[model samples]
Target: RPRPITPPCDLRLQSQEVQVNLGSGDGARRSMMGDSSTLLSYYHEDAKTMYEVFQRGLHITGERDGPFLGSRLPNQPYKWLSYREVSLQLAEHLGSGLLSQGCQPSPDQFIGVFAQNRPEWIISELACYTYSMVVVPLYDTLGPDAIRYIINTAEISTVICDKAQKAAVLLENVQRGDTPGLKMIILMDAFDTQLLEEAQKCSVHIRALRDPPGPDDLSIVCFTSGTTGNPKGVMLTHGNVVADFAGFLKVTDKVIFPNQDDVLISFLPLAHMFERLIEAVVICHGGRIGFFQGDIRLLPDDMKALRPTIFPVVPRLLNRMYDKVRA
Candidate 1:
């Protein structure tokens, strides 16, 4: 007979009892977690789609812009991006531009976004959401081959990139016929004329976004890091992403929900769900978000500049900070 192994310590403390009954109180009522343990939604309308989440903010706030997105240069303070322009006007223009460029406004229509945490990235994402299109994000660490694989797999037609270099990468892919589905490459920043001619020769349209309304089936086709093997794309619905923010909302609604006064610093990768959920929560509340200056070593400068109200922290970061303060 085998002897029972003792635990290092009773890490699993006694489970506490709850006050609510199944389906009687708020949140989702699941039997395993007991009555209303799960959050059904915290959205005022219980926003079922990304379109509604974007619209819900406007409806609640009565169309207030009030400095939404922010960014900065090296050692410079964060500059403002108006909420009315980004959340409303730019989205509409981009969505209309996509439609004009022959891209359909459907859930199956995928748009690629290859960039860091910037206003343009979120603006492009909002454009997709507003037009009922799916967003396929390709981050920097995703190598050339993986990027090609995603573009083909998702049948991505329009790809919005941050800078000229990323647009060049897509153009090269087009030149070699690696991305046949790719037709339009939208750069978020200025590019020289040489690149435009190169794009023209490759039979691809290139434009800078100075530039979306609707229900989306899939929210994001977020790819894995391919640590084990090739990267696998995970399909998430609008409800799936919104539910995360809604869960956050349910937790804070009674105490403090984020308003226009709230500010978030988006240094974390939106490729991961953590940052995406944080952005979603803030966006639903018309809160401000500031992007770091693309360097972790200089994040303290950004911290001083923005004085962000929200931070995406893990135990590791907290531990490091604790150690630094202790030292």
Candidate 2:
């Protein structure tokens, strides 16, 4: 027999009279059946830019000795990146290196990100933001034709890819003269001598931008999954992202309060809005993020190993977990 559920003594039905003022001048009031205790609110000043939010997060929590981001290592423990190390890498290595390489994309120009959820992916994203380049995320599961469509539609000149297979596809397109405007392809992983030599021989001049992008400028162009037809692009500004972060904080401050001690296990694709938003929120709160191994079948083991406090997931994943539990 199944165990019966118990009700708490505090559960009760009560009616309370609440008065709501229409405005300051009108002096009108309306009666509502609710108590003040039922209401919750949170307030915060809006940030001027997304970069400003990041800067504030760094200012508040960068001094802590705890790791800010981590990834699982093969047959070993997780490798971690401290807040200070992340900042240094963004400033000294990824950001500066891109600039030195002359990867100066124009305002509103799309820079493609073709990779899985990794530290390099985050670095590339932040580096693009630092120079005001618009990002176009390309999912790893997308085929060559879909990839070609996005590249052409967004007029992506430069692309940052993680694996050799993706790079080969892009190289094939470039060689076949399919992507006329394509200039450079940056591989996050180490590349062979032949690939590097071939890339150098291309006409694309890999250079950095001269000026920083403004808050109102378009930051990213997210594409829909295109279950119906062709994928469509949705442009969002830096201010839009900043406002969203601020709004989310205002709404969920009481329910989901993240702290330095909290650990967030990242499994969703960074290209998804939910994951990206949560990542920004976690960083703002100085929480640690640990990435799962890139296989869904390993999620249970990863969860066990990471022991995360917060798990943000989609309905499909949640349903699967529930089914597994029931089974």
TM-score of 1: 0.83
Tens-digit per-residue lDDT, 1-327, candidate 1: 646544322445423444565675654322232124455633556467776776665555564557778989986777887767776689878888888889888887899999888888888888888878889999878888999999998899899998999898888988898998899999888999999999999899998788033323788899987668778999988877776677666655655568878899998898888898887777777788899888877777788889888888677867876897799
Which prediction has the highest lDDT against the true structure? 1
Clashing pairs for predicted structure model 1, backbone only: 91-212, 92-212, 130-213
Least well predicted 10-residue stretch by lDDT in candidate 1: 27-36
lDDT of 1: 0.79
Off by over 4 Å in 2: 1-46, 197-212
Residue 71 lDDT in model 1? 89
State the lDDT at 264 in candidate 2.
86
Best by TM-score: 1
Q: What is the C-alpha RMSD of each candidate to the true structure, in Å?
A: 8.5, 7.9
Local distance difference test scores for all models = 0.79, 0.70
